[model samples]
Target: MRFSVFTLFPELLRPFTQEALLGRAAARGLLAFDLIDLREYAGNRWRKVDDAPYGGGAGMVIRVDVAAAALESLEAVPDEVILLTPAGQRFDQKMAEELAQQNHLALLCGRYEGFDARVETLVTREVSLGDFVMMGGEAAAACLLEAVARLRPGVIGDEQSWRADSYSSGLLDYPEYTRPAEWRAQAVPEVLQGGNHAAIERWRRDRALERTLARRPDLLATAGLTPQDSAALLSAGLSAEQLAQVGAPPPPRKSRKKTPAPAVPES
Candidate 1:
């Protein structure tokens, strides 16, 4: 896959494209990265890319013209043009996998107050990291790139490696341990130590469910819940009351104290 990034601060994003998993992908030509400087498309000697909002705003917005010029210069049409903005859909693993299927991508990184409103019209889609705000979209784009890169064939050594990743199966990944079988008085789970693959797998799934139930019950809303999964949960000590949580229930009401009112001021 190829990614074309349009930003004013290309230097900040350079190291990420050349390090760790990303670096390996780039070296193998499994992934290709292109950095485009919006300033290069600027019309003036100073090459300004941002300006005060037309009506009024606290911070400057990227000028639509500058961004358009950079986008227009691309020799090949991008499979998808993504404008990174907080108003867009929250990005996740599923989205990353979807993006990896695209042959090419153009990422428009916004800064200051954000891109000019017109810039949205130029892109095919928009994505946000989360509900919270960030200083710029470059870091978010880098994160997204890494997430997508790891899913690409030949990028990661083991194809099955991602199966156990948190969010891959809509459950938080089980805890992992390595090296010292006995460390600091804490021993590794016996299931993992024993050479029984099936038992170890069951242990992992059970622990993953337990962790997810404890931390992110919200994810269970749409996650896979098979007969075996239900049985596993039951075996893991979760009662029918917990499985019922997957279905509807009324909002919990506050329990009031039963203290009686005193006939105090009997004036």
Candidate 2:
């Protein structure tokens, strides 16, 4: 996949794409990055891309015309253009998966107060990392890039690794243990060390369920639980009533209404 990042601070974004898994992915030809400096597209001699808000706002707003020019200057338009801002729709694992399938992605990073309102019209989607605000969109763009990039084929060495990631299965990840099974008086779980694949898999699933139910029960509402999963939760001490509260359908109950007693005899 190819990603084009339009940012006033290309230096801030360059190092990240050149390091870690992203760098390896680029080197292997699994992913590509193009950093388009927004400042270079500024019309003024001073290379000014932002100015005081039209109605006298506190901080400068990125000019709509300059941003538009930058978008137009791209040799080949991207499949999707994303604007990073606080007001955008919340970016999530689902969106990352969706974006990973795209042939090309363009991320537009805003600085100062934000992009001009008109600039939003040109983008396909607007995404925000979360509820919090940041100094600039560069960080958010990097985050989105990493999230989407890792999902690309061959980008991550092991495909199964990402499948087990938290939120990927709509459940928190199962706890993992390393060497030194006995450390600081803490021993690894017997199930993990037992070498029984079936038992180990069951243990991991139950722990994932337990952790998600305890920490982020909201995820269970749409986690696509199976009969076996329900059984696992029940075996882990979750009552049917409690499971129902998390959107698990309760088992059917048989009615026991008594038959009318001998009314014909009294008549």
Candidate 3:
């Protein structure tokens, strides 16, 4: 996938893409980046991209003209031009999967108080990391980039890892242990050491259910559960109301293992 991240501080996002999994993906051509500096489109000697709001706001607002110009500079039309803002849709694993399907993407980083409201006209979508605000969209852009890039083929180096990831299956991830069997008086579960695949799968699913129940019970409303899984959870103390909310597992989406990346569309 190709990502054009438009930011005033391109250098800040460079090292993030250059190191870790993103770096490796770029090396193999599974991912691409065009960290275009937004300041270049400022159209001024000082390259000013932001100005005080017309209504006299406390902080400056990114100019719509500059942002639109920066987006127009892309060589290829992106499937979507994502504008990062606190008000956009709350991003999730599902959205990440959807984005992975698109071959090209442009991320518009907001600075100061954020973009002029009219800038929305030029963007295909708006995304938010969460409820809180940030100094700029560079950090949010980096986060969204990494999550989507890893879903592409060969990025994580393991297809199964995607399937078992938290929220990929509509449940929290099971516990994991490593190294010495016994550490600090804590011993690895015997089910793991016995090499029983079926038993291990059951153990994992059960643990995942337990964790999700104790934490985000809300996820169970849409999470697909097998008869056996429902039975196990029912036995494990899922109440009647939650059980009513449970649904049969939806058909699994097609896997994106071929080509350079898969969406895991973080679905």
Candidate 4:
């Protein structure tokens, strides 16, 4: 996937992309980045890309003309142009998956108070990291980029790793342990150590359901639960009524095998 980042401070984005998973992906050509300096599009001799809002706001607003010009300079139009701002749709795993399917993306990072309202016209979508405000959108752009890029095929060393990531399956990830089986007097779950593939899978699913139920029951409302999932959650101590509240069907009842009457001493 190709990503074009428009920011006044391209320096902030460079260090992140040059390290970790992103760096490896870029080196492998599985991902690409075009870091455009928004200041280059500034019309003034001073290269000023921001100005005080017309209505007299406290902080300067990124100029629409500069932002639009920077976008137009791209070699090819991106599949999606995203403007980062707090007023936009919330970014999530589903959105990341959707973006990974696109061939190219352009991320416009706003500085100062925000982008000029007209700047919205040039982008295909507006997205926000969360409800809070930040110094600028550069960091958000980096975060958004990493989220989308990792979903691309072969970017992550283990594809199953991403599938197990929190929210990938609409449930928080199950607990994970590594190396030292016993740490500080705490031992890893026996189910994990036992080499029973089926049992281990069951254990992971149950833990994931339980953790999601305890921490973020809200996600369960729309989560796609299989019969196995229902069974797991039910076995994890969630009552049928509680499961119903989250839209999960009741777990299937286990059939009881009646023991035949004991032979009367062969009489």
Candidate 5:
């Protein structure tokens, strides 16, 4: 996939894309990245792209005319342009998977106070990493790039690796331990060490269930539960009320109290 990033700070974004999984993916010809410096499209001798907000505000806002010109000048424009901002729809694994299927995308990053609200008319949609603020949108663009790029075929070198990623099944990933089998008094679960494939798989599934219920029960309702999973979760202390939460809208983030992780098979 091709990603053309519109950012005032390409320096902050360039090194990240050139060195991580994104780098490797590019090396293998599975991904392409184009960093479009917004400053290059600025009209002034100073290459200034922002100004004091209209009607009074704290920081400078990116001027829409300059941004509109930049978008117009793209040699290879994308059909979908995702503008990063706190007000946009929240981004997640599901969104990433959908985006990965697109042949190309344009990620527009905002700086200072943020893009002029009128700039919204120039792109496909807006996306947010989560609920909080950042110094700029470059970091968020990089995150969206990595999330979408790594899902493309041949990017990870192992198809199964990403299939087990957190949220792939609408549940958090199970815990993993490596290197020191015994660390800080915690031993690797015997099921993993016993060389029994069935037992290990069973252990992983149960752990994923227990962990999701404890930390994100809102997910269980749509986790594609099987009869086996229902029976197991019931044994693991999932209640009628919690079960009803299935298919219901997920609770507000950071609002629900955590439930204790119920026990699953350890041996």
Candidate 6:
């Protein structure tokens, strides 16, 4: 896959492109990336890419002219043109999987307060990391890139790796251990050391369900659990009662009682 990032701060994205998994993807030709400096598209003396909003807001908006020009320079139409902003669809693992299947991706990293509303008209889609805001969209873009990269054909060696990852099937992953069975007085699960593949698989599934139930019950709503899976979870010490709590809403807090007024001092 080919990813193109148009940003005012291209340097902010360099670190990710040069290290760890991303770096490996680049080296192995599993993925390709191009960082286009949005400032470069500004031909004026100061090379400005933002301007005060027409309605006069606290922060400057990305100028439509410069942003449009930057996008035009890409020549070919990307499979998806993603604009990073807080107002768009929430990005997630499913979206990452969809993006990895695309032939090309163009990411526009909004800066200042936000992108001009007109900029949205050109992009094919928009995505937001979550509810909170960030200093810039560069980090969001990097996140999107990493998620997509990991799903590429050769980027990850194990095909079954992602399938078992947290949220891959709406359930969190089970605990994992390696090296010497004993570490810091905590021993690895005995089932893991037993070399019984069937038991290990059953144990992992149950643990994954338990972990999800404990940490993120909201996930269980869409877990699509089967009767066999439920039995497995129960056998692993998690009862139907415990599984019931997975998606249960917390009870409302009790209101505090008001203090009584003191009797009048004057007679």
lDDT tens digits by residue: candidate 6, 93-152:
889888988989999998889888999998999899999999999999999998888888
lDDT of every model, 2 decimals: 0.86, 0.90, 0.88, 0.90, 0.86, 0.85
| Local accuracy of candidate 5 as per-residue lDDT tens digits, 180-200 | 899999999988888899988
CA RMSD of each candidate after superposition: 13.0, 6.8, 13.0, 2.1, 10.2, 15.4
The digit string of per-residue lDDT tens for model 3 on 47-99 reads 99999899785989999999888888777789999999999999999999999
**TM-score-based ranking:** 4, 2, 3, 1, 5, 6
Q: Which stretches of candidate 4 lie over 4 Å from their true place?
A: 259-267
List the pairs of residues colliding in candidate 1.
none
Task: Please give, for residues 71-136, the per-residue lDDT of candidate 2 as tens digits.
Answer: 898889899999999999999999999999998999999989999999889999999999999999
Candidate 5: misplaced stretches above 4 Å?
Answer: 247-267
Q: What does the lDDT read for residue 200 in candidate 4?
A: 95
After best superposition, candidate 3 residue 90: deviation in angstroms? 0.4
Comparison by lDDT, 3 against 6, better one: 3
Q: Which number leads on TM-score?
A: 4
My TM-score estimates for the predictions, one after another, are: 0.89, 0.91, 0.90, 0.94, 0.88, 0.86
How much does candidate 4 score in TM-score?
0.94
Error of 1 at 59 (Å): 1.5
Model 3 residue 239 CA deviation in Å: 2.1
Kindly list the per-residue Cα lDDT of model 1 for residues 1-267, writing each as its tens digit.
999999889998999999998988899999999988889988899988888898886999889999888999999999999999999989998898899889899999988999889998999999999999988989988988889888999999997889669998888998999989998899998889899999988788878878887888787666777666676666666677877677423324457989997778857
